[model samples]
Target: MDQEKVNEFLGRFVADLAATEAAGSVVIGQRLGLYRALAEGPATPEEFAERTGCHRRYLTEWLRGQAAGGYVAYEPKTGRFSLTEEQAYCLADPNGPNLPAAFLIALGMLRAEPRITEAFRTGEGFGWHEHHEDVFVGCDAFFRPGYAAELIPHWIPALDGVDEKLTAGGRVADLGCGLGSSSLLLAEAYPRVTVAGSDYHADSIALARKKAAEAGLSDRVSFEVATAQTFTGTGYDLVTMFDCLHDMGDPLAAARRVREALAPDGTWLLVEPNASDTVEENFNPVGRLYYSGSTFLCVPNALSQPGGYALGAQAGEAAMRELIAEAGFSRFRRAAETPFNVVYEVRL
Candidate 1:
C-alpha cells in the first residue's frame, strides 16, 4: 500500500483500541456511581472516597480513567475530579433529560461476548431467547420512559401527518414492542384507539401488560407474545417497529407478514439505527459502534441469512425500497429521519 494508505490504516487501528478502552471507562464509572457523585461539585479524591465509601487509591484510579476518557475533569493542583455541566447532564443524573441510557444499553450487550462469536460463526443469533431477561433488565428502567416521554413526541409527529392518520379509532400494532412505551404513548394520545404491543419475549409481554395496567391504559392497550416473522393480525391502520426491525431473524418474512397485516390503506413504519450508504462508510465510528454492538445481540438475528435484515450501511435507501417492494408493499417512502434513525413508511 502507499504511505498515505498505510497511515490511514494505522490511524483506524489506534482509534479502535482507544474506543475499546473508552468502553471500560463507561462501565466502571456507571458501576461505581462516580458520575453521580461528581454532578454537584468538584471534589478532592479523598472527599469523593469518603462520600462513596471506597478506598481513595482505587477511586483515584477510576477518576483518572474517566478524566482520560473526557467524561470528567481532573485538576492536578487541587487533587479533585468533577463533571462539566455537559457531562453532568449526559451521565451524572440518572433521570436527566440528556442521559446516555440507550448508548449504555448497547454497551451492556457486550456481556454476550462468547455468544457473539458463536453467532458470527454460525450465522445465527445465540441465546437471545435465553438471555432476554438480562438484556432487558439492564436497560428497561432508563430506556422505557425516555422512549415514551421524549423520543416519541419528537419523532411521531414527524411522520407525514400521522396525527390526522391516527384520528383516535384506528388499530395500531407495535411490532417488537419492548416494554410497551411506544404503544402506551399511542394509547394515551388516542383514547379511542386500541394499541397492541407484541414481542417474542414472554417476560417483556408481562412487563408491558403490567406497565399498561399501572398507567391506567389497560383498557386501550394490550400485550401479546409474538414474533415479527409470524405475526398474523390484520386490518391494522398503522403498524410500527421501533429500533426492533434489525433484531428479527427473518426480516423479509417479517416484512411480508407486516404487509399482510395492514389494511389496503394501512401504513407500515420501519425504524432502525441509521447507517451510511456504503460498506467503507460503515467502518466509521458510529457504524462500527452499531455493527459491533449488534454482534452480541441484534446483528446476528438481523444479518442471519441472505434477505434477512440488511444493515443500512451495507444496503442504503434504494435497498430498503427494494426490500419493501419485495415484501408485497405497493410503495415505499422516507417518511422521516432523525439523528440516529430513519423512518420508512410502506404502503400496501
Candidate 2:
C-alpha cells in the first residue's frame, strides 16, 4: 500500500474511533445535566460545577472533551465554555431532537456486545427484552420528540379521512406501541378517540399504562402486553405501527392481523425507516446509521422470534409493499416522509 494512502485511512479510522469513544461521555453529560447547565450560560469549569453541584475537575475534563467534539464552544480568552444554538437545541432542549438519547441507545445495546457476538457464532437470537434497560428508555426518549413534532400535525392528517374519523370518536389500535408514546400522542390530539396500545414486552406495557394514567387519559387509552400478531382488538378505525414493523419476526403475519383488526373503511398507518429499493442507493450517512442500528437491534429481535424472516431496518418500500399486498391489502400508498421515516397508508 502507498504510505500516503495508508496515512489517510489511518486518519479516518482514528476519527471514527474518537466518535465511538465519545458516546459514553455524551451520555454522562446528559445524565448529569451538564449540557443543560452549559446552555444556561457560559462558564469556566469551576463556575459550571458550582452551578450544577458537580466536581470541578471532572467537569473540566468533560468540557474540554465536549469542546474537542464540537458539541460545545470554548473561549481561550476568558477560559469559558458555552453551547451554540444548534448544540443547545440538540443536547439541552427537552423538546429538541434529543441527540444524547441516540448515544444512550447505542451504548445500552453495545453493553450486550458479548451476547450479540456469541449469537453471531451460534445463530441464536438476542431479543430486545434481553438488552439493557437503557435500550427501552432511550428508544422511547429518542423517538418521542419526533413523534410529538410530526405524528399529530402531519402523519395522522396524511391518512385520508382517518383524522376526521378519529375526531368523530373512532377507535385506534397501536401495535408494537412500546411505552405508548405514539398512542398517547394520538389520544391527546383527537381527545375523542380511544387508543389501544399493545407491546410484547410486559415491562413496556406496564410503563405505558402508568403513563396513560399520569396523562389523565386512562379513561380512553389502554395498553396490553401482546405481540403484533396476537394483539386482541378488532374494528379499529385506524391501525398504526410506528418504527416497529421491521422488528417483528413475522411482519407478514402482523400485517394480516392489522388487516383483520381494521374496520371495513379503516386506514392502517405504517411507519418505517426511510430506505431505498436498491441497497447501493443507501450508502450515505443516514443509511450508515440505520444499518448499524439494524445490525445490533432490529435484526436480532426479529431473529429471536419464531419466523426466520428478519426484514432489517433498511428493508425498503418495495419489500414492504409486497409484504402488505401478500397480506390481502388492496391499496398501498406513500402518505408522508421525513428524512428518517416513511409513512404508508394501507387499506383493505
Local lDDT at 284 for model 1:
70
lDDT of 2 by residue, 202-229 (tens): 9999999999999999999999999999
Listed per candidate, the RMSD to the true structure in angstroms reads 3.5, 0.8
Model 1 scores what on Cα lDDT?
0.73
Can you write out model 1's per-residue Cα lDDT over 1-348, one digit (the tens) per residue?
599999999998887777666766665666777778778689987899888888898887778877876878988898888988888977876556434455466565766677776766776645355554546754565555556654456666666656666864889899988778788888887777898889887887898899999999998898899888766579998898887766665677888888888888888877777776666877776676667656566666556444545443234576677777888888788777755567787787
TM-scores for all predictions: 0.83, 0.99
Clashes of 1: 0
Measure candidate 1: CA RMSD. 3.5
Q: What C-alpha lDDT values do all the predictions have?
A: 0.73, 0.94
Best by lDDT: 2
For residue 257, give model 2's deviation from the true position in Å. 0.6
Error (Å) of candidate 1 at residue 255 is: 2.0
